[model samples]
Target chain A: MQPPVLELVDLKKNIKNKEIIRGINLTLGPAEILGFLGPNGAGKTTTIRMIVGLIRPTAGSVKICGYSIADDFIRAMSNVGCIIESPEMYKFLSGMENLRQLSNMDKRITRQRVDEVVELVGLQKRIEDKVSTYSLGMRQRLGIAQALLCRPKLLILDEPVNGLDPAGITEFRNLIRRLAHEEEMAIFVSSHLLSEAQLMCDQVAIIRQGSIVKTATVKDILNTETVEWRLDNPVKAARLLKEKWGIEALRENGNTITAAVGENRLELINQVFVNEGIELRYSIPRQNTLEDMFLDLTEGDEIA
Target chain B: MLRLIENEVFKIIFKKRLLIVFGILLVLITAFAYGQDNSLNRTKARLAGRIGITASTDWKKLCEQQIIDLKNRLESPYGHEEDKPATRVRIEQLQYYLENNINPLDSSAAKFTTQFMEQSIFLFLPLLIIILAGDIVSGEAANGTIKLILTRNIPRWKVLLSKLAALLMLEIIVLLMAAVISAAVSGVFFGYGGWTAPVATGFRVIGDRLETLGVVNVPQWQYALMVYGLAYFVSIVVGTVSFMISVLVKSTSASIGVMMSALIGGNFLSHFMSDWKITRYLFMVNLRLTDYLAGSFQPVAGINMAFSVTVLSVWAVAALAISFVYFMRQDILV
Candidate 1:
């Protein structure tokens, strides 16, 4: 069997006696897009750095294409391409020249491959101009071009769409999806934008305070059902539901209550509310999104 | 490794750093050549006034007259005892020139090239090398490009080794540029006609007395080669040291500043503390390796070619070892 394209087992990092990345375990396979979501200072970048061999992990292993990063860094990194923080190229040289410089470092990368990646990233128009003159989106595209030059099986991008415009973000999302689905490349992207992750990744890992609090398939996260009620006495309804049906509902407002229950229980909830002398104005079944799960799992920490 | 080095060299050239070094050399060499021409004319006029002869008189007569003046000074009671050995060496050098029919005072392109290197080897040439090598690694960190390169599949040691190789290659180029510019610029003024002239070398100092036991005469071009060879060696040492600073420091300006201060401060320390026994062990004091070949008076006694070269080699090796070990294990947090 083909090994996973990227794997992190029991990963941990301590910076100056402070545990930064606490015991992260992750696996990504070909044709998979995993979104590494975390708040600021939540060790998202640190974990990516370890995977790419920029920072050594305290006591864990990062295996890329079945090769251990510590024991076989060259072979491990050869199968991986990454943009750790920002896609910084040599601004003094033209984009084409920058690509050429990177391509020169690896013998497997060819001139034709460089041109193909440039075209793939839609950077052919400004590739001949100095990067100092290129816009942020153009540089991001160029960074992607550089990452794709080696035909890597594992691609890691950190905040890939941070400086991109809405249109550029959509285009980047489409490109990433295509790369994952069409080329069967395993992409591990980190971002603080929950909506972006919701729209992009197949699997989402939400990290908080150096640990992975939740990891789930996007389909499973979105499939989670919650029921909302508009009633006269939300506090009474919340208490009564906990007392009777043993369902914990959040008092969203004076007239609203929401609980993590499916649509099948909505009628029963309304019937009980009506029977218990509580007026039920309306009720609706709500679909939980990745954002709701992320907020709930992270407990409303600062995302950025 | 070769591809990595090619990439480094490509970046250096495109950055126009070599051009800057070349420009500085051009401006300084031209000024020095012009100043040297004026100083030579003034010396000829002074000689004409002293001997009651025209400046165009035969060079052999000038040598004889200079020898007589030196001999009289040696006989005079007012002469300092410490100055006698240097004066004696000068008198013997003029005598040798006179016997061999070589005009020691004649200015030429080859002589000017050798002289420029002799004067620059201690300080000026090292400064140029620092400017070239000081930012090779730190500049990448400052610009955020270090992450790009270090994340590649190649090992960090290979990357650093390639950078060092490219820097050494450029150091040699800087020396060549210095020699070529000095020769070409001075040739316009000095007529470029001393390549075959005999130059006296290998004089030594043995206990406050001039020692000429190893003295030999070689053509001017050969002497220039030896002088430049020493200059190249000094340049490599300085380059390696600055390369270490580049790896240790994360900012280009800071790296350059630290090395510049160390170099200038070393000069000051050497001048003020030459009497201290341990000062002879400092690499800065030994930078004047060419002076030993010229048989010049030692600022700090008991140092020779082998001693200085050994000190410099040790410094280069230590700096390289520190650079590699630190860089290999550095976290590269930037």
Candidate 2:
């Protein structure tokens, strides 16, 4: 219903005669969390960098909040807050002072906004401490606090959870959800953790070798399609389901069979298997996970 | 722009190394004042002992007392004509020597004394400039902060402009401190009242027409102003050159090292190039613009202060232009 907050129109980037990104197009709508998934050197950082105006794309344009990054950089960048790679910080300054310095980049940022973001990132207690003394998680929190300083309408983070521990990652996930839900901000984050992306993102865009392989809603990608089943013997189960229910299924492994079966047909397969005296180890229709979808889509090494 | 400039200035003042440099200047100025005072006292004592009188706080009073002593002995009721000639001759000889041979106790020597008291330009001011100018952009690049600052949506030129402006401000601040320190220290020993005293360094450089360049007469304060202007110009030239190197090298040590070598090498080259007409055009040759004050080396047989200023000016502008263009286009990948 609303126009996309961020758009990449056939973006192509070439450096020293080597193409990095090839005709990549993407759009991030308002209040949506789009996970940019890619392996190392897969152009995730490169694409995010172009969106933040860090590097000029060899071809095409990136628009932030309807303003082109090249045509109107000030206006476009004024509303976009980003953390590319590891957040660069002045280590000698206090965490709060780092936020204060970044806050000065935009006139709209106020003292109250700084305080709010510091607390939002759960760093209020340690905000007065020098950045050099901070843990990796605290530093990332401080970086995010700075990014949120100007109350940017769109937030772009590259590997925001890379160095965070479990607790820090959970807090970061909650904070990002709050920003998108309560503040109505569009957040585009790049991460190699597909499970984390599945748990946190509303939508996910899979990138392989600098190109987007797929983009879909988390519900559609994980919950609504392609049921997988685990049985005592996948080959025997596949044969039994094919003969009795007239349903075709593929053997995934020694004991796992995946089938595109309707909801009603799931009961029929289980009943036939039970009558044949086949002991069921795990026979429920398996919901597809982000990791499974990722492996299914990408051809090369799956994990980044 | 003003706020940006203010922020830049704040960054400079907060740097601990720069603060220490200023502190060192203050200590040196204090030590110099003490040494000059001790030397003045010792000279007064030595001269008073030769005249067979104790050194007094007031030297003119001592001379007047000597004249009255001679007059009293001449007008005494027990005095003989024989005693009169000897006393009169003694008084006349002393008066002639005092008037002709000895320097009048005046503020005229303040300029020469102050210069001798303080470390010359070759040592002090250039080192001060190096403390700040050496790290202008290279420090940021070396620390990996350039990428952060540049990515903040501000134009690259604005960042460079802020840095250049900040360094210039720091230069002005340091020069001003030096001026105040020099004045205060020079004031203590010289007893502070001959701002208009003529200061002539006894050195001379013979140019075309055997033109003696050193004896140009100017008021002490005016002479100080000339020195300030010359040093100020040199600082600008150094700042611009160091800034260009800062942009090119991307390491603080390299930028400072290259500029220092250039600075030292420039002085060395000028020594041999006093007769080289083409060497007069070298940027470093004009570095000692104030040397023309002390009747030191002139770049060419006929070159003047205006010619030196022109050479330094051209070099500074060219360096800044290169810095401005290259920094805006740098990859900033770090």
Candidate 3:
């Protein structure tokens, strides 16, 4: 099997000896989107910076498409396209001029490529206007347009949708998904908006206090051990499950009882509820969202 | 590397203040030329008034009459020994003009060009440089756009080099604009041609007396070029220091403010503390490189062309090196 598009091994950072990022390891393959979740000052931006070569890592290395960032910075960065934080632009320049300036950094970005990106990001109408006249959402589109011009194989976006409206976010999300699948590019996105990440990403890596606490597929995070049960007379249902199966009830809402489900617990719970003559409305596995899972994992810490 | 510099150029011209600055500069040059033209006309009328008293058209007799007028002025208390050599040189020049049947009071554009170069070295160009170069590095940092560029595959030193190249290009353009406007406006007010007219330079002031023993005469056009040559050198030296300061600071406004303060403060201190030996080493003192060309008095004696060039070069090189080193090592926080 080929190496993943991006691989981090024991990535660590220490600023003033305080350990900003501590031992981060991750792998992202082509055509995949990994959501990076962390609280405020949890070192998401620091890790992104280290990956893009903005700040040197104190220890360990990042490999992009088999090129080591520390040893072959240019080659590694060449395959990567990133937007860290809100997309700030050269406000004095026209949108077209700004794109042209970025295009000059590489020779392969032809005029046709520039037009293709402008079309991709839907900025053709106001491309000639100075960026000072642009709304924050327009700048975001322009930033993404520039990132795509070089046909990068890995994309990193840090809070890329902060200033975007709902419609713009939807469009941006669709565009990112298309880029990942069509171009076979890996994407690493760090966002505080868990709902957006849930809808957009394939996997999520939850970070706490600079250490990654969990890295799981979105399906796995959404379908963890927690299971919800809907029952008539849920107080009686919870007592019957505790007494009959020696299982503890985790949470009880008005019409529902949720708990840490054991292996094959669905059928067992239904059989126990039926045998005890406790009225049960329905028993279905709850589809958890990324927000619920993230809150559960991060414990409601501040998100920077 | 060249493309990076092209990107930098795009950024600078995109700034709206560029055209505004050039406009003010041209208007000021025109106004200054108009004023100088009026003053020259007044001087010519006064000289003609003195000449009208003479009955003969004989050149030697007219020269003698002008010499007598200068002598009367020198006899007054306002004229000190310090003015003697320049006055004597002027009298000799008039004698030579009379003998050659030349118009001594022609008021050519060459004189205005020289004056413009001399004033611009101390004032106009440095201010323009401070406003433009001041924003080159720090503006990006403050705007957080620096993260985009630094994350590119290029080395940090090359990025600094691109900015430095853009700055140097802007400095050259400023110098060229100074030369162009001064010549064009003054040429409109006064007659256009003075290329071959003699300009006497290399007079030294020795012990309260102006010495002219080694005076050399060059054509006015050559003299204008020499003046701008020295002014251009000072512009580079001053502009580079401003670029380095821009790298050190994080905001465009603060960078421009800091550099402007140093320029204004340096000039202010040079005026008040010129007698101090340490004052001679200040970059502001060395900004007056054209003063050496005119053989003017040194604020601190023994400061000369070679010394000023060496000091300014050292400062410029040091500032440039520091800018590269700091930018290369700096962590992009934004």
Candidate 4:
């Protein structure tokens, strides 16, 4: 069996004696997209930097394809391609020239590979133009193109969709999914867009205060405690359930009543309503979402 | 490593307006050449008129007559005491030329190139070097492109070396530009000659009147080589200091400012406080090591080749060490 594509065994970083990144243990397997979800100043970028060897970790280790980042840095780095912060390149150079410069680091990438990545990112039209002329989306695409040039087994992107347009975001989302599926690459992304993460990530590790508060598969995060019910007279139904069953419905949006309850409570809720004179409308158990889990896990102190 | 250096060279060519330095050098050299040509032409005409009225063909008599003429000119009301040393040196030079039957006005590659280097080596060459190398490291940080470089899996020291190598390459180009421009512009006006002719140098000031001690007759081109060679050396030392500052300072403009003040103030301090023994140890004060070649007079004695080289070397190593140590261990906050 192949080893996991990435392994972080309790990585930590301390800046000025302050723990910027506490112990963060994470593992990403082949073809899995792991979202590093965190609020501002939660050390997402710092952790990524440590993994790429841009900065040394104060404690623990990062293993890429079973190679320790601290002991076998170059080999570990050879397996990883990342942008720990905003995508940046020499603005005076053309997109193609930027790729060519990066290609010097790894001999495996050639002109053919550069052209392929550029075409894949849809930057062939502007590949020859200086990056100074590129729009935010174009630069982001070129950033991805550069990361993809060497065919890294583990790809990390930090806030990749921050500046993209709506159409560009959708296109990039599809491209990332395709890269994971087609190349069998283990991809890691750090973002605050919970909705975007819900759609794009296979697993998520929510970080708060420099520590991993929770880590779970996206499907499990969506299998949360908060459930929504579709019933006739949601307002009256909410009051009736609160008064009769002492079960508080948290919110009522239109004909839907939402409450913090487990999936097993739906049958009991319907039984109680059926015993009353209120006619039972069709019950729709709204799926739990990552957003609900993110807020719940973070204590709702705004994800900046 | 070769590829890293090549990448740095590429960035130097494209990321900054290096051509601006080249262009400014071209314009300044051409303008200086134009002015020198007009003055040289007028002096040539005057010398020819003087030669026309001479009655004797004896070289000794001509020298005597020219000496008297120079004396009378010095005594004239228009001549000032401040101009005495320069005027006296010109007279001494003329006497040597006449005694040897060489026409000083005859434009030769040696004469023009010598004059060109003397005018360039002091402040002009260093100014241009400062402009080109001022942003070597700091500019990368300011542009946010340092992330691209540092993330390349290459070691940090190797990356710094690449930048230093690129700066050295840039220094060579600037020196070459100066040489080629001066040679070309002065060649056009002076009809370049005397490249192989012997030129006398190694003069030292004594008392008030002009005196030449241990005059070495080297080929004109050989003399030009030594002059440009020393200028290039000084520029590198200064450029290295600038690079060191560039690494430490994050703001490109601030880096340039810090180095410029050191350079200008070095010269300023040397001029005002040459008596202070402490000033002799400053790199900027000792940067004029070429002055030792011409045996130029200094208010102090410690500014020599050995002193300058030692100071510059120490500063270079210290700065590079500080740069590597600080950057390697410190956080890249940006």
The candidate scoring highest on lDDT is 1
- For model 3, the stretches where C-alpha displacement exceeds 4 angstroms are A16-18, A228-257, A262-264, A270-285, A300-304, B42-106, B205-211
lDDT of 4 by residue, A1-304 (tens): 7779999988988888888888988889989999999888778888888888777888998999998877876777777777767789888899988898899867777889889999998988889999999988889998888888878899999999988998888898998899899989999999999999888999999998889999999987667566566766677778877886677886666777777656587788778777765566677666778887887788855533
If you assessed candidate 2 against the hidden native complex, which CAPRI class would it receive? Answer: acceptable
For residues B191-221, write the lDDT of model 4, one tens digit per residue.
7777877766665545444456566677778
Q: Give the per-residue lDDT of model 2 (tens digit) for B19-77.
A: 87678777887777677667766766766766666555556645655667788998998
DockQ class, candidate 4: acceptable
Name the candidate that leads on DockQ. 1
Among all windows of 10 consecutive residues in model 1 chain B, the one with the lowest summed lDDT is B203-212
**What C-alpha RMSD does candidate 4 show over the true interface residues after superposing them?**
1.7
| Candidate 2, superposed: residue stretches over 4 Å from native | A1-3, A224-284, A295-304, B27-124, B185-194, B200-216, B272-282, B299-304
Q: Write the per-residue lDDT of candidate 3 for residues B1-334, one digit (tens) a residue.
A: 9999999987888785567668877998998999888876665556657776422244455556777787677677788765665565455556555655555555677778888878778767788878778989999999988988887777778889999998888777877777787878899998778878887667565533445667677888898889988877888888899999999999999999998888888888777776678877778777887876666565555666788899999999999999988997777786
Name the runs in model 1 displaced over 4 angstroms.
A232-236, A243-246, A252-255, A300-304, B64-101
* Candidate 3 lDDT score at position B176: 79
lDDT of 1 by residue, B194-263 (tens): 8988888887866556677788889999999999988889988999999999999999999999998888
TM-score of 2: 0.78
- Fraction of native Cα contacts reproduced by each candidate: 0.92, 0.31, 0.69, 0.46
Q: What is the overall TM-score of model 4 with all chains considered together?
A: 0.85
Q: Order candidates by lDDT, high to low.
A: 1, 3, 4, 2
lDDT value, residue B58 of candidate 4: 41
Ranking by TM-score: 1, 3, 4, 2
Ranking by DockQ: 1, 3, 4, 2
